[model samples]
Target: MQLTVAPIPFFWSKDTWSAFYEEIAETSVDRVVLGELVCSKRLPFFQDQIPGAIERLIAAGKDVALTSLALITLKRERKLTADLVEMGLEVEINDLSVLSYLPKGTNFSVGPLVNVYNEGTLRWLASLGATRICLPPELPLASVEILAKEAEALGVTIEVWGHGRLPLAISGRCYHARLHGRTKDNCQFACEDDPDGLDVATLDGQPFLTMNGVQTLSDSYATTVHQIDQLRAAGVTALRLSPQSQGFADLCHQYRALVEGQCSSEAVLNAITGQTPEIRFSDGFLTGDRGVAMSTPPIAART
Candidate 1:
């Protein structure tokens, strides 16, 4: 199965952003959907680096695609969506409204943020020139199998969210700004301080979620270490791994090994846990269990 690196959902400096893509060009990933996917306000800081990064990745034989903002509101954001088509590379549509801006018969891809939950939605998007789609992370494997089967018939590549924190929701109100007693406009880019996102806790101090500007994400990383065989069996074409700040290149290598059958699921999970023991891993979203539940033995949920 192919591995895809999803766009960074956090606010990162231009230097760190450029360096991450430079490192990605050397990884085992086949395709990368890179652009601002969460907040459009963060785009200006690193927008200039996109062209160079795309050139480098293409030279390295990696398929690169630009991503649309997950939630487009302002007039400038709409203009940005329209301009994505002007770029020669493929556009990965995160918001459905982006379709209204694309020219007829323009080939594009769909990001997981779009609600492609059923076969009808899948077929409709394919008809509108979506060549590939990364299914939402909350989908169960049963739904994934059904959609993958339909996608195969429609000649669309199906990708599953293989790794990273699950993006739960996006809001117009900025949680980070609210936390600091500031409004969204005058927050002064507070989200940049926590590159990976600020963790939130319950009333009792139990970890609950992560806040990144207006986006809310899961506390644990959603991993597919145990579902590689199952996803491949179901005709899933690729696995999309989201960007993280630390040890990301090594994380790609580990997932690559798992995809190539060079390592067992337990071994891969063990290696990941060894590297970041404090971080929890979950496959429950795909296994029909609680979204935060982690499978013991790593392969126990294969059925």
Candidate 2:
């Protein structure tokens, strides 16, 4: 299976964003998805830099696609969606509203956030010009297997979320602002403080989820290193690795090694040991269990 690097879900400075993509341009990943998918307000910060990044990745022989916002509400956001097609890049629709903006017969991609739950939705999207689709991370193995088969029959590529904190939900209210006791409108970009995302703990102080502006994610990163064989057998075309704060390029290389059969899943997990002691990994969504359950064997003993 090919490796695809998803767009950064966190808020970062313009220089940091540029540097991240510059480094990614040289990674072993075959595809890259860029553009804002979380908050429409943050678009202006890095809007101008997108063209340069896309050009660099494309020049480096990587297939690149742009993403639409997960939630499209405002007039400005609607206009942004309409303008995305003008960039001449494949647009990954995170929201269905983007469908209205895409020109007829223009091929697009479907992000995981879109509710493509069954064969019907998958076929409909394929008919609507979706060349590729990243299934929602919450899907079970049986669903993935069924959809993969259907996708292949329809001549569409199917992808799965392979790594990174699971995006659990998206809300109209900004969690970053709520965390700082401010409203979404007057929050003044509180998300900038946490480059990755602010951790939200349970009442017992256990890390439960991550709060990123208006997006909510699981604390544990969802990985599929151990399930590569099954996914490949099911005809999955690619594995998407979401961007994180640490060892991202190394993560891509390790996944590449795993896909190439040069390294085992245990070895890939071992490579990430020192990066974060608090790191937790899960693959249960694909295994048909709870989203946060770690179906794979633990790499290091947790305290």
Using lDDT, give the best candidate's number.
Answer: 1
In candidate 2, position 277 carries an lDDT of 56
Candidate 2, lDDT over the whole model: 0.91
RMSD of 2: 2.6
Overall local distance difference test of candidate 1: 0.91
User: Cα miss at 77, model 2 (Å)?
Assistant: 0.5
Per-model root-mean-square deviation over C-alphas:
1.8, 2.6
Which digits, one per residue and each the tens of the lDDT, describe model 1 over residues 1-303?
A: 999999999999999999999999999899999999998889999999999999999999999999999999999899988888788789999999999988899999999999999999999999999999999998999999999999999999999999999999999999999999999988899899998899998999988799999999998999988778789999998999999888889899999998887877777777877777777788899994789987664445333
User: What TM-score would every model get versus the actual structure?
Assistant: 0.97, 0.97
**lDDT of each residue in 121-205, candidate 2, tens digit only:** 9999999999999999999989999999999999999999999999999999998898789998898999998888998899999
Clash count for each candidate, listed in order shown: 0, 0
* Model 1 misplaced stretches (Cα beyond 4 Å): 298-303
Cα lDDT, model 1, residue 143? 96
Candidate 1: how many backbone clashes? 0
